[model samples]
Each structure stands twice: as structure tokens, then as C-alpha cells.
Target: MKIVTWNINGIRTFKSGIKKILDSFEADIICVQETKVTRDLLEESTAIVDGYNSYFSFSRGRSGYSGVATYCKDRATPFLAEEGLTGLLITHEEAVGCYGDQLEFSSEELLALDNEGRAVITQHHFTGADAPQTLSVINVYCPRADPDKPERKQYKLQFYKLLQSRAEAILRSGSHVIVLGDVNTSHRPIDHCDPEDVDNFEDNPARKWLDHFLSGALENGDTEDQFGNISQKSASGGKFVDSFRHFHPKRSDAFTCWSTMTGARQTNYGTRIDYIFSNRFLVENVFSGVDIMPEVEGSDHCPVWAQLSCTLLPSPKFPPLCTRHMPEFIGRQLKLSGFFVKVSEKQNILKGYKESLPGSQEAGEIRENMNPVVQGNNIIKKRPADKEAETKAHKAKKSKLTKTETKPQNNLLAFFKPKQTQLNPPSPELNPDPGSESSACLTNAILADDTHCNSTQTKSSDVALDTCVSVVTETKNQDKQDKETAPVEMCRKGPCSSFWKEVLRGPPQPPLCKSHNEPCVLRTVKKAGPNLGRQFFVCARPQGHASNPQARCNFFTWVDKGK
Candidate 1:
């Protein structure tokens, strides 16, 4: 099997030269990122040659944002489908699920995931080889939070952490996995080529992109996240091998992607950010003929291809395949921008697992090793004020430390200060001023998982790590009850089939939102179908980023249907 991954930059452009491009590579399967097309256009996106089946995953909120697509030869595709929090993949035609009969997710949680269509996993049944091996092909267009925006940088970090957990789960399920896409981060300095920008990385530049943070391995001379423990490795240890590097050990200049603005491609100054990663077992199956195709044209990124020597046993029976969710995209000329979160979604998911899957070791361990800092991903940060703010905060912190260091040990005021004592532990969010916030709080506020920090203003840096961790631990103890109360079908079918009513607590309609008592308005689904015209109430002030609490609580509601 010969598979390739490329960031097409845009699907429409890629389509114009699709035939010529595919013929040049002769790949059995080609996965493209940033396809720039939404799920609504999935049926119309069948322009690829006659023998291939196309699958896509689209972004939820913004149109023409992050999107991915895969074209697999019919002969190589035994069973293909998409998977995400939607609980099931919804298509214009019908809905089909991956986890068998009962949905493994709650509707509310799945609805929350509808914002980002970054992940799409499809199963391909290969019958031509030895034993029938089920392969899970996951394609992702990871968030590229530019540094100019602090929030987006944080978002990208959170996205990577989430991706790690999801991939780990797939590996645990005993599946052959091949993950491909625009990973966005060049694994090593040599993987990238920009003399001026490259010099800035002479000293370890983990801050540029937490490479070790994403891979779960320790980068030389760095032990913690660039901003402290704002991010950590997947509990699974990120068992992915960069196939390009694995195949060509000495080819430092062999870049798979280049920058358009810098004329980097013209001079061949590029980076191998787009990748084809395989699991430890699958790495042995990849042939040595992996090629980085710089000649292909359509986007700034070129294609990376690898041949696999594994035996693919054909399946006599295939699962019922259906349309996976493909949200939105951004082609050339259109700008792509957004705030990214740094915290791990697994923290919440792990908490849920601990309660629901009682005695699950993975959940317990992840919680125990949880990092207190929350960060986001993106392009190199562009916010100068963030650095200035951090600097002023640091100076104030230094002065406070020096004063405390010289002060009498038993000063009466020491007891008066809440931080010195355990009784009045502070809530990081309560303090909004950056200069006044305690250094300990700053660390915890930025690193603490979502349960405690979400609002940009509320993400504080005053409370100590122990205080924040203790608070999180206590919150975890009560989360089984406080977690979002989603409405589930009495029968895991569709909307309720029977008219039913049960006594409910509190005012019938929600009082103004508990986050911001702001006015809320009704929003409708624009996609096609029965629910396409459905409406729900949401907060008036759109934060654009839902990773925050204001956005989370700002949008919440659903209508029940009866027989």
C-alpha cells in the first residue's frame, strides 16, 4: 500500500489538477488536509477520478476553516467511515455510528464537539493480503495557533493533547493505525529550513511549538513545557514515528512543506511539517521508497508518500459504511484565524471515565499526573502585550519574593497575608489584575485544566500549584454529579418517541446564563434535513471560542420531541 498526505491548502485548487497529481504519485490512498469544503458539499466533492471513494471531516463553527479529506481506491477500501464526538457521523443522506448499536457518547458532549471538525477516522478493509487486518486511518489538520495571538497558541496545545489521547485510545483498541496530515510542527530544527528563523532556534526553542510536549519525549535541555507544565505528553507516550525521517535519516534538507510568503519554496527553503506517522508496529511495515514530492503544485505544502509492505487480508463482510462529518475550510485569499486552548480535554474525559468506567487505571493515572497550566497552540505568538504583561508580572513577583526573603520569619503580617496560610486559599479566577496576581496563581491559572479556568479574564496566575491541584482534586470528587446534565433519549433511538414528563427542579426556563446574566437569542441549524431548521437559545455575546466557560454556558438548550 502506498499512502500520501498533503495540505492541499484548498480543495477547489487541488481538484483542478487532481488527475495529474494522483497519477504522478500512484498512491493507493491519499489524505489531503485543508480541503476547504464543508460537509454540505461532500456529495458534490466527488470530482476525484472514477475508482476512488472520498471521505471528509469539516470544521464546526467557522466556514472555510480547518478541513480534511481522503481519497482511497475502491479496491483498497473495504469499509470506510468517520468518527467524532457527534456520537455518530451525520451526513446529508443518513446517520451511521462507529461504536456499534448504543452510542458511546452523550448528545450534549457530541454537540459541543460540533465546533471543530479536525478529526476523521475511517476503517479500510484490505482483503488482498494475508490475515484480514482492520486499519484505522486518521487524518487531522491540527490547529496552527500563531504566537501573535496568545489564546490561539493555547488552543493548539489543547488540541494536540486531545489528539494524543484520542490516538492512544485507538492504539489500545488493538487496531492498525496510520495517522497522516499537516502536523504543523517541524519535529526537529533540521526538519525546517529558514536561515534567519532557524538561528533563533540555536538555543532550545520549545516555545515555538512544544515538539517534545506533543511527542511525549523529553527534548534536550528542556524538562517542562516552554511555559512550565502548561502542557504534557499523552498517557500513551505518543508512539508515532515520523515516517519521512525514519526512511531518510541523512536527508536534512529534504523538506515536505514550504512557506509561500517568504518565497521559501522558490529557493527550496522548507520544512517537513506535513507527515505520515505510523504506530511502532506499522513502522516496520512501511517500505523504504518513501518520497517527499516537491514537484506537485496546488498549495504551499508538497506531498509525502510511503509504501507499506503489510499483508491486507480482505474482509468477507464489511460494516455498514456511512458519511462522516466534514465541517468547513479556508482556501487561498481567505484568512484563517482563531483562539486555541492549551489545556487537555482528557482531564475532563478522564474524570468522566473514572466515574463511569470505575477502576480504570488510565483515568486515575492521567488525573494524578495532570499538569496545572493551560496553554494554546498557533503560529509564533504575535502579541507583544502578552510578553510585556508577563514581564511586569514577573518583576512584581520578583520584588515580592525579595521583600519576603528579607522580612522577619515571624512577622505578624505574614499571618495576615492569605497566601502564607492554608485557611484562605485563593480562587485564581477571583483576581483579574495581572500585576497584582501571585506568581503561584499565574502558573496554576494558566495551567489548570478547564474545570477551574476557561474565561480569558478568569484565567488567573495567582494561586499556588498545590492550592489549584487540591481544588481540582476536590472538584473531581464531585464532578460525577456536577458534569453537564445532557438530555438523553429514553431509548437510544432518536428524539423521544413517547410523550413523557417528569417533575423538574428550578425555574422552568433558565434564569439569565449563570456565566454572564447576558441576554440569550435563538440560533438555528443551517444544514439540510428535518433538524436542519431546528432552533436553540444561545448567549448574546459570542466569544467565538467555546473552550471558555462564558461560551460553554452561554450556549445551552434543546427541545424534546414526542410520539
Candidate 2:
């Protein structure tokens, strides 16, 4: 699969440029950095391409700022850091409030902390290849424009440490991992077009950190020269051996980025800050790597691409899929209608029983029996109870159901228990408040799962590595329980099902101002510009209305309350 990495600067402004690159280059996986758009903004924005899954990790910036996004034609699965590693430190005041307490320190302190943009990794699964390949691709936009600042340099060092730890973990798992992005550093003097200017050359902190990482050295200049002087180092690494590097041995100078603001490519004034590095074992044969320096108008950075070929391996086998089954004891009780009817009528039935029957063997048995059933699929079967059994149950119960005959019968169970339906038809006047009781039952079911649910599928290999089945099963069970107990609204004499249904069917109108009790809307008036005649919403209420409109009421929602 062809994996490409590029720092698209601000994704919103450079989206068209990015689309052009993707359309022409045909990359299987693309790792992007400096997206500078929030998840909410991205959701509102439309992508120009199809057949690609995109993942974005955005910084908390109102306007354009530091951010990153990843796109892949293959199946892209988001892998968050175990302890919330996918976040950026606030550099300004507005960002401080956006993240709130999520940041460890104050805005000032965080500014003193790391200022490099966020780092995000997205794993892609490729099936067509011989082996089941899982590629961990990372995008990083390190700090820039503060070449003289010591604090900024320290931040870059810390960033490299964090990145190296993450990369090592992936490499240890025997997975093919690729780390790429704009490192904002030129490894050698040859990496820059003007190699003769030493006075203008500031120290390359990004290159220094990367060199330490690759050489496993603790300090700068700690390792001996493996590839001769800096000039020769650049020459050996710079060239396209053939059109693609793996095909030929001759070196050709290729640069990835150019200075657009100064028209510097004419004077050959550009630095090689962008790079792609793979695990040593994974780079058996490097086909080609090149920096595309086209005249892109919107962004300062250019897109980079790499192509490689490797020996295919057989797909690894995982353990057989285990089927989850509900416990038989609870399944029998759910089959009968009486259990549901009694529970629905007595809202505090479980609490009352627990209080009265404390330490009782029957109470313990009931708890044990319901535990697995609640955790598995949230479906509790009710066993049939005749008149004698009902009498016995009532004697054991701590609370009595008020107006027992006025309970709504279960329509779902009526099909199975046809005899019970014929013997005692449900009264037409029967009405049960399902909303409150159902919510209470759902809460209890979720709590029960929290206490008793355990992964049934166990792997003999590393337990930590094989948690996919367990994680998927837990999510599935939670979804099932949530669906079963979700509120069922009573629709009016209309084609739609509920209040939300009608609201979703059309565009929502602006809500009324809470303080003034009048219609309010946020308006964006355009100033003098060529982009004229654009309409925006404002408070429709006339000036000096009955009450102060208080701008736009944040608490107010635009929904028809009558529904």
C-alpha cells in the first residue's frame, strides 16, 4: 500500500490543495498535520473526495491554529493514547477555556510547556495483501520560528522523547510502523539549498533530536559518523538512485519544501524539514521517496510522497470467535409476562425486596441469577406463574402493587402465552407509566453490567495485545442495553413518530430569546467586500422590545414544545 505523509498547514484553507494532491498522487494512506479545525467544524465542512475514511485530532482554536488530520483509503481505525495523549497545550487565552481542566497546568504554564502541535496516530488494516498488515502512521508538526528560544528547544526535546516511546511500543509489537511529518529540521547542511551561508544558519533542533533518536544517543554529537561528513551524509540521502531509489545506486539531489513567501526556489533557498522513516526491518527495499515542490498558493508547505515494496507474509491466525449466551435461569423468568407486569407496577419493588430480605438466601440467589443476564444482553426472561405461584410470590414480596389489575399487559409476550391472554384479557382502561419505571430499570441494568461483566474470550498469547474481542463485546452489550430501555414517545395524530422526528425532518428555526421571550438568532453581517448579498441571522425581535434580549440565550433550544 502507498502511504503518503504531508503537513497540509491549515486544513480548512488548504482543503482544495490537499484534494488536488490526493486526486493526482493516488495514495492508499495519507497522514496529515496542522489541520487547525475542530471536530465540530470538520463535521460541518464537506470533503471533496470519496472512498476514504478520515480521522482528525484538532487543537482548541477558534480561528486557524495548530491541528492535525489523517486520511486513508483503507480501513482506518482510531487508536487513542491509553491516557488521553491526543490533546494540545493551550498557547493563548481562548484555548485555555476550550480545554478547561483537561490541561494539567494554567495557560501560562502550558505555554511554558510543549508548544509543538498535536501528534496523532491512525492504524490502517489492509486485507488484500498476503499478510494482515496493520500500519501505524503518525503525523507530527514540531515547533517552529523560535530558533533562538531555549524553552522552545526543550519542548522539542520532550516531544521527541514522547514520540520515541510511542514508536518503540509499536515496533516491539512486530508491526510495521511509519513516523513522518514536517520535523521542522534539516539533518545536514546539504538539506538546505544555500549550504554556504553559516551566519544565517541557526541550529536545527528538530534534526538534533531525530539524530539522537536514530543513533540511540543521549546527547548531541555522541555517535561517531556512520555516513561520513555532513556534506556526504546529505548527498547519500538526498538522491533518487533511479527514478525510484531502489532501482539504481546513483544519487540525485531532491528537496521536499521551498520558501513560497520570498519566491526562494529561484535562489534555491529551501530546507528539507519533511521526512518519512520506517522500522529497520520493514525497509528491506526502498522504492523511492520525493518531495513535491509544486507552486501551491495557499500553504507554505509542500506535499511529500514515498513508494516502497516488501516481501509479503502469511496472515496470522487469531482465536476462534466466542459466542455469548444469556444465562438459562434468567431466560426462563423473561419468558413469562407476570414478572414484567409486577415489576412495572411496583417501581420501588427491587429496593423494597432488598431491604426486607437482607442476607436471605433467596435474595442472594436472585442477585446472582440476574447478574450475568443483565451483563450479557440486558434481556431478562420472565417465567410463567399460575395463581398458586402468584400467591406464593406475593407472600414473599415486601411491597404490594396498588391496583394490580390496572397494569398494561406485555404485547410481545402475549403471542407465546395465548392461553393467559384468553383467560384474562387486559382491560382497555389499564394504563402504566412506562417512562419512569423503564429508566430506573435501565440504570440498574447498566450498573449490574459494570459489576459483573467479564471477557469470556481469553488468549494464551499476550493478554494485553489480544483485547480486541473483549473491547468489542463490551461495547456491543452496552449498545444492546441502551436500545432496549430507550424512551418510547407517544406520537400525536400526525405522520411523524415523535417530537424529535418532526424536528429532524426539516431545518430548525432560530429559538426565542429566554430573557426577552422573543425570537433570537445569531447574525453575521458582511463588511464592505466583493462577497456581497450574503444573508445571516440576527435577533428578529425589534430593538427596545418588552425585555432585554440578552443576545442569544445559550440555554434555549429551537424545538416546538407543543409536540
For lDDT, the strongest prediction is 1
Candidate 2 has which clashing residue pairs, if any?
Answer: 35-67, 239-252, 333-381, 333-382, 333-383, 334-381, 334-382, 335-382, 336-382, 523-537
The TM-scores, one per candidate, come to 0.48, 0.43
TM-score, candidate 2, is 0.43
Model 2 segments more than 4 A misplaced: 12-21, 47-49, 74-117, 126-130, 195-205, 215-228, 231-253, 286-298, 310-563
Worst 10 residues of 2 by lDDT: 317-326
Deviation (Å) of 420 in candidate 1: 98
Cα lDDT tens digits, model 1, 1-563, are 78888888877764555666665677778888887765556544343356565666666555677777777666565464664523334433322233332244355434434345667677765532456666777788887767667876656665565555566566677676777888787765667664345435533333333343334443323445442322343222557656665556456677877666434565566777787776756775545557788987778888888888754443343223323122232123433533332457655666565443222233444544543323465433233457787998999999999999998688787777865444233455543456543444645644766345545543233234446555456545545433333244224444353433332332234335557876565567766767787766666553323344533354566533321
lDDT of 2 by residue, 397-483 (tens): 634464554677668876877453332232332222456533333344445453333355245322422333344345557667656
Instruction: Give residue 426's error in model 1 in angstroms.
Output: 86
